[model samples]
Target chain A: MHPRRWTEFAIESLIRVLGLSSIGFVLLIFLFLLKEGLPAFLQVPPENLLGTRWYPTFDLFGTLPLILGSLLVTATAISIALPLGVATAVFVREVAPGWAREVLKPMIEVLAGIPSVVLGFFGMTVLAPLVRETLDAPTGLTAFTGGLVLAYMALPTIISVAEDALDAVPKSYRDAGLAMGATQWQTIWRVVVPAARSGILTAVMLGMGRAIGETMAVMMVTGNAARMPTTIDSLFRPVRTMTATIAAEMGEVARGSTHYHVLFGIGIILFVITFVLNLVAAGAIFKKRRRGGLR
Target chain B: MRPKIRVDHLSFYYGDKQALFDISMEIRERQITALIGPSGCGKSTFLRCLNRMNDTIPGTRLEGRVLLDGQDVYAPGTDVVDLRRRVGMVFQRPNPFPQSIFDNVAFGPRVLGLCRGRDELEEVVERSLRDVRLWDEVKDNLKQDALSLSLGQQQRLCIARVIAVQPEVILMDEPCSALDPIVTLGIEELMKRLREQYTIVIVTHNMQQAARVSDWTGFFWLGRLVEMGPTGDVFTRPQQKLTEDYITGRAG
Candidate 1:
């Protein structure tokens, strides 16, 4: 082969290897997690494992509370983030003037780049006390506080993706709407938004994925109580997420103990939830593409 | 008969660049007027000015008067939404919203609040679809996605969308440029039928199309109106050297 041809062959092979290795790494991680976590499911009694208590020192390993905790916090975060994020995206993409859009786009990106730990710190110092006083809750750190922090964390991802979706709508659609005597607001609401619906749904799913997987801010503001949240008022009470439980106890527990394995089990569960979320998001985008390539 | 639309000394500018110079013409009521010229000759720009569609673009400025029913459309305090409803438009490409055919045709009525209820809206949608001769092919699938239709059907749906608003004047900016020859002829036939009720203005690069369909033909060159007369006179009798050369394939 010519020297240039040989170089090209080497680069192509290198890229292919690098691409395949990431998938290989993911499979290896899943296998390792199963090896470490599967024993907890098998060795522990089914009743005990599915119970609400999670006192590892007492040999009780109920994960219902942690699972429900994660659900409540993530649901709250998404409920708060979805409307605000989508509205901000609409303002930036459709309504904002040129200079304001230029300024706001980078500002949103910067919001995303702010360290999650720093946001956790801010939540710990400022938001918790505010929530405690406003609601007269037993503690400042609660599921609601954690949800507010995570909502902020998820905002940038939602806004950017939704903005891209709205931007992808063809300009000709706008022309058709305007020429039909629809007002500007009417056109956006009736025509442009409905066309971009799937893409926007994908954005919400991805943002939910981000919020559910987030650990640091959630750990800081949730007060780590590990109790089932059954009542509506539980939103204002302390809770421990699966992620926070895994992060907080992993260092002190013995390496081969059931507690350690249960923590890995929690990791497995978190992985599955986020994986499903991403799959749904990807499915939405794929459906959009198959329906005439996003118009 | 009095003209349906009259353009008086119109000039247009996009940012710092002028796109159309002082151009004037009359669009007769219930007749077809075609503007023909090479690309970028301001024919489409002139068409857009009829309904103030150019206002959507930033830094686009228009000077002069466009009168619809003896009222200046560009006059301050004029309701632009109502003006556009009075003078509907079709674009160069078939652009249907990613929605159902029923919803696409019903969009104008829904937004303008022209229909009192769903039944009335359905009636308007059916009437508009029948006007564009698209009802039989799509009536069974009015709930289907508009983008799923063939190119010709989509174009007709776009026309139905415009007609649902019940505009008196329809401005078509090269409406047949994107279709096959047979589809083009079909659309031309539709235009001819549409002329009995609506004043139609079309912009086309095909000089033969202008000769065949237009009652009045206006030739634009370098942002200026080169000639304006009856289509028969403009195509057959040589008055301006530019119009003659353009029609005869000598100069565009």
Candidate 2:
């Protein structure tokens, strides 16, 4: 081969290796988790593994409360985030003046740069006390507190992604709407939003994932209670998530102990949930693009 | 001929940059008036001014008066949304919304609340589609996506979309520039058919297209109206040296 051709081939091969190594690392991690986690499932019978109570010290290892806790927090965070984030995105991309947009875009990026630990500290110090005093609850630390903090955390992701989607809609669509005598708001709602539907869905899914996998902030504010929520007003009640369980208990447990293996098992479950969320998002995007291309 | 729309000493500016100098013209009712010029000579700008489409752009200003039926369209508190409904526009490129064919045509009427019932809306949609001569081909596939149509069909659909609102006048900005020669001819035929009911003003870079379809023609050069008259008189009878030179292919 010519010298330039040989150089190109070598560079291409190196790039491919670098690109594939991350996927390889993920597979290795999954295999290792399975090795550690599957043993705990064998030691703890199926009934105990799937039980509602989760007293790990007394040999009860049901994770239903933790799973439900994560679901409730994530769903509440998304409900709060989706409308606020999408509306802010529309304001930034479509309604704001040039200077306001310039200022807001970077300000939102700065919000993303805030550390999770600092956010956890803020939630513990600021939001918890406010929640307790305002609602006149026994304690400030509750699922609602965790959810509010998580919603704030997820806003940056949703706003930026949804703004990009809104921006991607063609200029002609707006003009067509306006020339048809539609008001500016009507045009934005009827034309621009629908055109960017797939992208907005992606934003919501990503925001949900961020809220679901969050550990430190949720743990700091949720009071780490490991019991089933008995009341309809359980959002104001203390709860603990699977992620928090792993983070709080993993370091002190003896190596190769059932507790250690159980932490790994929780890790596997978290990984599987995130994986399924991503797969569902990818499938929806794929279907949308295929239908879009068919025309 | 009685003038349907009149422009008196109009000028336009986009952020301190003058795009149109003093211009005046009369557009007759149920007649086609063609504005012909080279690229960036302000023919399209003048066309957009007719319906205040330029108001959408930031930092743009209009001077002088534009009267529709002797009522100043640019007067204070003149309703822009209502003005657009009366004076509809078709863009250079075919821009159909990503929606069903039936929905695309029905969008204007539905949004403006023009029809009282579903049957009335369906009739308006069918009539508009038939007016554009597209109903025969697309009648069975009304539920299909509008983007699934050919480019020619999309342009016709856009025209039908405009027609559904029942505007008194239509502004077309180089409406056929994106289509092929055969499709352009078909659009020209449609334009002639549409002229029987609606007053039409078209801006085109193609002088041949202007001469072929227009009853009255105006030549614009460097934001200024050089000459305008009956198409035959402007093309055959030599008047202004610049106008004659432009028609003879000596100047633009």
Candidate 3:
């Protein structure tokens, strides 16, 4: 009670510093993007968004191809990651024995720790070449290849977080089901699965964010050409992606030129897409806050 | 009367450490059998072993014979799933599924594939709920989540879930430990009524509860059955000194 003034002062200043710094950093990045990227929208002729062409050298920079490619690769990656990740999570949390769990858990954590560049290389050496030979296509770098790489790349985040979610389910629920003659699988599907639904959703959205924002991996595996993502059933074909386009173009463009602004614009678009996903992921997390998993 | 369940030379071990020592007992049909003792007496352990609930734990081993109506429950070919279907269990805490009250009751019937149609499932749910005396209260709100119910009501719902599959044996491990006095009495009355149709085995720490409910009572001490007889006789004149001391408050 006697030191109320000092305690209050210390607490207030510490919180203010942390809170303000977070907001300040966010504001600085957005302001930079706005200043450098806003002019592209106000060009003498507004760029066509739904078109499939991007010709910056001839004073024409339409982002439709890059946007489509990014969307295609991200969607493909998510479709692959969702099932594999959730299944791995279920096996690890529910079915795996103690020794296997002890061995596998660290293995998954190690997967998470593996640098994205190495995974990119794996796609180049193993996945992409395999895709090329299987599909009999010209090149391995394609939207499908990027998705496959990103799936293995984002595996740990989805599985680890979702496993934690499944593990959070109260033991009483499982026991009650088991006591009522529900088999192990039934208990998981009917009780544990439903209870961990919100968490799984959160994990999916988080994994989506991880896959979509990935630059180096997608850039390496996906053939970096500013072209439309052509229809291909297999991953063994070349496809251009938005992040790759921006990263490729940003280095060569002169400062304050229209091409540079277009790259900045692509950066802004990428940022916004991930921003929206983060908002969705954050909302899912908020809804799941009280569910506080298993026992 | 013939015994519904007979345990002969039953011993339980967690790996090498023994928990139950040379326990033998007979449970009659349609009667409440209370296993009563202080903590660490293996009373709860013995109750769980009856339904093979202990099998869920890792590194646990059991020896000897547990017979349900002359069939060896621990036989090499005995299907644990089918065995569990006939022997129901209720834990100490009220463990209602996160789903609706209706789904909770329907869980067992659905998993066991006992009912074919929605109408038949509804009948089982209704009958089970009525048996537990929870039908009228939750009949209209059956679609509502189970967690919405009060603690006592949730416990009853758990009972309904067990009874839906129509198990002949019911094993309760300190079923009322988490309930208040009023709820416990409600449960006690339910158990009294249930015993007329199903064999009921309950493990309780409360001495007076065993006297009030059980027809046959077994007193366990440290990992052995100290005494077993009619509840009235055990309460009035326990044969073993340890049982008498425990009943008379001389020692645990």
Candidate 4:
């Protein structure tokens, strides 16, 4: 073989190894999580592991409240975010004039730059007090506060992604709709939005993932109350998410104690949930792009 | 034949760049008026101006008048939606909505509320498809995606979509440019049939096509209409040196 061929082969192999090593590291982390967290499932009884209460000090690690807390916060954030995000996207991409698009895009992107901790701090000081005063709740630090902050945090992702989706829809589609006597708004809703449906769905899923996986902001505002969310009114009440539970208690627990294992178990659960969500989003995006290619 | 549309001293501009020079023409009702020109000579621009499609582009301006049935279409209260419904357009490329075949044809009628209900809408779709000579092939697969059809079929679907609105005037901008020669002939045949009901304005780079399908032909050269006459006279007689040179393959 030529000497140049040998050099090329070596460089290609080196790059291939670099790419494969990242996957190897991910597998190693999953293995380590399983080793540390799987022990808690064996140590604690099944009922306690799946119970409603989460008093770790009382030897109770029922994750139901924590799971519900996360779900309620994430769901609330999504409900608040989806419509606003998609609307903002449409406004920015389709309705806004050129100068407005230039100003609004950067401003929305700037929201993504604010630190999560700063958002949490803002939630604690500004939003929590406002919520307490306005709704006359006992405390301002509640799941609703967390959700509001998370919704703000997730807006940039949803808006930018949905904007990109709308932008990707061919100009010809708009022309066809317009030439067919449809009004601009009607054309955008009936034709352009449907054409970009898959991309918009991907945007919503990604926004949901961002809301669900967020920890610091949620931990700061949710009041860290590990209680069962029994009623619709509990959305404004204090609650603790699985991520918050792990973040707040991980440092204090003994290294080899069952408490430490339980925190790791929560981490594993978070990992699995996010992993599944990301996978589903990826599959949906791939399918949509493939269908778009047929056009 | 009666004059269906009249353009007087029309000039178009995209921002500061002028696209169409001052031009005047009369499109006859139930007749095919073909505008033949080289690429970027403003034939399509002039076609779009007929129905105000250029309004969608920001910073574009038009001077002078385009009258449809003696009504100034560019008047302040002209109601553009109604103007578009009356003067529907077909593009150079087949741009079928990514929807079912039936939905694609029914889009215009449904949006305009021209049909009263589902069966009426179905009737319009079938009639429009039949007019385009595509109903026999597409009727069985009306629920399938429009993008699933061949390019030739998609163009026919687009024509059907435009016809479904029952427009008085049809503007086709190089409508056969994307199809094979055989499919092009089929579209030409369909255009001839359609002209009996709707006044047709077509922009084509193919000069032979202008001679073949059009009753009247306007030769455009660099944003200006150089000559206008019956297609036979334009093809056989030497009027302007430029028009004669173009028809003889000596000039663009």
Which candidate's TM-score is highest? 1
Candidate 1 chain B: 10-residue stretch with minimal lDDT:
B238-247
lDDT of 1 by residue, A216-273 (tens): 9999999999988998799999999999999999989999888888889888888888
> What is the alpha-carbon lDDT for the whole of candidate 4?
0.92
Clashing pairs in 3: A168-A293, A168-A294, A169-A293, A169-A294, A169-A295, A170-A294, A170-A295
Interface RMSD of each candidate, angstroms, one decimal? 1.0, 1.4, 2.4, 1.3
Per-residue CA lDDT of candidate 3, range B1-252, in tens?
Answer: 789999999999988999999999999999999999999899988988887878889999888899999999989988777788889998899888877889989999998999999999999999999999999999999998788788899899999999999999999999999999999999999999999899999999998999999999999998999899999999999899899999999988
Which of the predicted structures, 2 or 3, would earn the higher TM-score when compared with the native? 2
- Report model 4's chain A TM-score: 0.93
lDDT of 4 by residue, B1-252 (tens): 679999999999999999999999999999999999789999999999999999999999999999999999999999999999999999999999998999899888988889998999999999999999999998899998888899999999999999999999999999999999999999999999998899999999998899989999999989999999889999999599999998899987
The order by descending lDDT is 1, 4, 2, 3
lDDT of 1 by residue, B1-252 (tens): 899999999999999999999998889999999999999999999999999999989899999999998999999999999999999999999999998999999999999999998899999999999988999999999999899999999999999999999999999999998999999999999999999999999999998899889999999999999999999999999599998998899996
Candidate 1 docks with a DockQ of 0.78
Best model per lDDT: 1
Q: What residue pairs clash in candidate 1, if any at all? A: none
Model 2, range B125-170, lDDT digits (tens) per residue? 9999999999999999999988889999999999999999999999
Query: How does residue B148 of candidate 3 score in lDDT?
Result: 76
Residue B92's lDDT in candidate 3: 90
Ten-residue region with minimum lDDT total, candidate 2 chain A: A286-295
TM-score for candidate 4, please give it.
Answer: 0.95
Candidate 4, A107-225: lDDT as tens digits = 89888889999999999999999999999999998989999999999999999989998998999999999998899988999899888887888888889898988999999999999
lDDT of 3 by residue, A1-295 (tens): 5599889999999999999999999999999998888787766255364456788888767687788788888889989999999999999999999899789888997898888888898888898888888877888888889999888878888898899889889887887777777788998888898888878888888888888788888998998777766655533456677788877778889999988887788888888998888898777767555443223
What would the C-alpha RMSD of candidate 2 be, to one decimal place?
A: 2.4
Which candidate model has the greater DockQ, 1 or 4?
Answer: 1
Q: Tell me the TM-score that candidate 1 gets on chain A alone.
A: 0.95
